[model samples]
Target chain A: MHEGSITSQIVENVLREAEKRKAKRVLEVHLEIGKLMFLNPEQVHFWYQMLTKNTILEGSQLLIEEKPGTVKCPKCGYEGDFQYVDDPALHMPMPTLNCPKCDGTVKIVSGKDCFIKTVKMLI
Target chain B: MKINDVVKAEEGEIFDIELDENILKANAELAQQNRELLRKQGVKAIDVMGSIGAGKTSLIEKMVQKLKTHYRIAVFKGDLTTTIDAEIIGKHGVNVVAINTGKECHLDANLVQKALRRLDLEATDLLFIENVGNLICPAEFPLGSEKRIVVISVTEGPYMVVKHPFIFMDADVAVINKIDLAEAMGVDIAKLQNDVKKINPKTKTVTTNCRTGKGVDQVIAALNL
Candidate 1:
């Protein structure tokens, strides 16, 4: 799964930061995961624990903050949260890429980020 | 190693370091470099993504048949294991590089960077990267192409466009392949095309029956090749 790959990246980043500061232990990792991304937080947490085992990040807390998906429509000059189309066939609610006001092709302004905001460690 | 030290360590000297870094930045930077390299070499590249049995290989073969005499074509076939698709495309006497992802579901920018090193980009005019037959994972990883094409056949059912909106959102050209079976399968081609347009209006939609080379020229035109 892509979640496994991304979580490994998180673990790698945390380990690198820990070693750079010569930190004795890592306490927490703060992540800003966007809702637009296909990543599942539970899957990310599962992979994080598995990847961080026997490392300085073992037993650390992963604090995730999910950001909303937002878009900007160039045609209608509409900027706001994207709408979702719900169906029984969909695995989850699918966010529409069209502008809410004009149904124009909207450019993604936010909610695609998977960032490491801050690392809390014992130096 | 004691419980007391563990408890004390949790409460002592917790420093929050500010490093607001995107995890996907590395891949994005590599993709940019790839775009530059291809542009400098005068090579046009397309990243083709779709589900398994979406006629991706057949469409490439048809393209090679039509454009082989006009330009030098090279292909990078991404599959989890076998180089079967590469073998099929290689029969056309073009440069075919098979990139086996092994256990990976999709080819990342790093993998493409390595593949680029092995190819003679200067000698190539058109490069087609057939991504591992997957709709979801490949959307997240861009392989640095001039265009991103997502192929979906009518047999995949009506909800493919709605169920996987991100891929359609990211696609530059959306090809609805195997239109020959639309009547038998009871699928409405126009509705599928409309769905793609609703998701990303900028995306050019093309319908093709790659078996008999029907609508293949339209695909070539859509790619601007």
Candidate 2:
């Protein structure tokens, strides 16, 4: 799983940044995950908690910003944004990944990255 | 206080990503270590990327047969369902493990690393990653592969090259399949070759008919087999 690999990198980065700021304890950690990344957030959180057991980031709550998938319509060439969610009442599918404008195959452009945007630590 | 959905007057510039510093640093470090591991083992990986039914599997089978005679090869098959391809290659007497991605669109580096564990790296020479049959997601994830080969078929139309040039852009080699029926099917090799060249000036495109094993020698020569 990429989560294991991504988790390790997150730990490494946190430690590096912690050393830079000369902080002994980390307060909270925040991460923004894109919907179109094809990355599993639960797996990421699971691995992050497991990997950060005794590290500086241990016990820190992970703030996950859930971002939706955005697609570009090649027909109308309109890159409109939409959330890929399920409508239980409407009986719609989860991955309704189509262009709303011209009803063409949607090409994904943005929303695929794993990074640490902010960190709070006790100085 | 009550609030309603906020509306903006202007469209926002693309964020490029939902940037997460933790995940980015973690992924980068893991990838860095992965690169080192590949280097230490001298594990040269090649990814075969193409659209569905572009004869990707046929070319892979041919190459594996040729390479198996000389090199200790292994395969990391990424398919949405069924390990049939992996099973077939394993019969050829090389280590082949399939990564069945139930719904995911692509195979990332993290997934590749897990598959590599089952393969004996010391005994392996050519590690081939038969990526999920698609032009998009496969191009995004770099599974620490040394090379990427984009396989295109003439039946699909030469225009596919122009539409998805990034596949060629991320590739070190390009293979066009189903060339035996080129004339019969009214598919022009010249136009296809030109379309490929327009996207990548350096991508080596070779026409092949996997059914007859025609024009596959160039691939062998290119890989120094």
Candidate 3:
């Protein structure tokens, strides 16, 4: 899963930051995941636990915050949250890129980021 | 352990560290490196992404058959386990590198960088990176290619476009492969093209029947190669 790769990166980043601060161990990690990203928070947390074993972040708490998808229409200056088409039968939700105001193509404004917001460490 | 009389022993203190950094920064940086290296070698690399039975391998074969005489071509076939697609491309007398990603759902920049090391970039003019047979994951990972092509066959049904607009948004060219089967399958080719346009207006759409090599030339032209 891609979450494994992403978790490895997160671990690396946290360890590096902890080392820079001369910390004894990591206490917590904060992550911000955009809605547009295909990452599942549960999968991320699972992989993070598995990857942090025997490392400075072993007992650290992983906190994740999800960012909503937002888009803006250039033609009509329409800016708001993206509408997703959800059907229980299809078992898939697709985001609509068309603008509701002018029915024009809307540009993605947010919800594509996957980044670490902060970290808590024991000094 | 208690040597200091003037100072008192204290437990370690916990502090908060702020690091607002993107997790994909490393991958994106590597992708930039690959892009520069390819550009320096004057190699035009195209990333091909599609479903398993969307005829991605066949379309690459058709392209190699048509352009092999005029240009030196190479291919990087990405799969979970088997080398079947790589073998098929190699049989066409072109250089092919099979990258077995094992359990990876999509090929990332690091994998492509490793594959590039094994290829003679100086001797090759065109490089085709056939991504793992999936639409969702590949859309998130860009392989430092000059053009990204997404192939969707008529057999994938009408909802393929609307269902997966993210891939089309990242694609530079969209190839509707196996168009010859549209009439037999009772699919609307025009409606498919319209759906693609609705999702991504800039993406150039081409209809092709790779079996007969029809529309392959147009695809090449669309890539401006």
lDDT of each: 0.89, 0.73, 0.89
Winner of 1 and 2 under lDDT = 1
- Between the candidate structures 1 and 2, which one is better when assessed by DockQ? 1
Tell how far residue B27 is off in model 2, in angstroms.
Answer: 4.8
DockQ of each: 0.72, 0.13, 0.55
Candidate 1 lDDT, A27-99, residue by residue in tens: 8999999877878999999998999999989999999999997889999999889866676666677777778
lDDT of 1 by residue, B51-81 (tens): 8999999999999999999999999999999
Clashing pairs in 1: none
Clashing pairs in 3: none
Candidate 2 segments whose C-alpha is farther than 4 A from its true place:
A1-123, B1-29
Writing each residue's lDDT as its tens digit, candidate 2 over B1-225 gives 777887864332211122245454433455566667877998878888899989888888888877788788888889999988888878888889899888877777777778878878999878889989898767657777777888888888756766665566556678888987777778889877876665444567888888788878897676555
**Share of native C-alpha contacts between chains A and B (below 8 angstroms) recovered by candidate 1:** 0.81
What is the number of backbone collisions in each predicted candidate, taken in the order shown?
0, 11, 0
Q: Pick the candidate with the highest lDDT.
A: 1
By TM-score, how accurate is candidate 3? 0.84
Compared with the true structure, model 1 gives a TM-score of 0.92
Winner by TM-score: 1
Q: Write the per-residue lDDT of candidate 3 for residues B1-225, one digit (tens) a residue.
A: 866567654469978878999987777789899999999999999999998889999999999999999899999999999998899999999999999999888899999999999999989999999999998998887779899999999998877888787898777799999998999888999988987877677789999999899999999999998
Best by DockQ: 1
TM-scores for all candidates: the values are 0.92, 0.61, 0.84
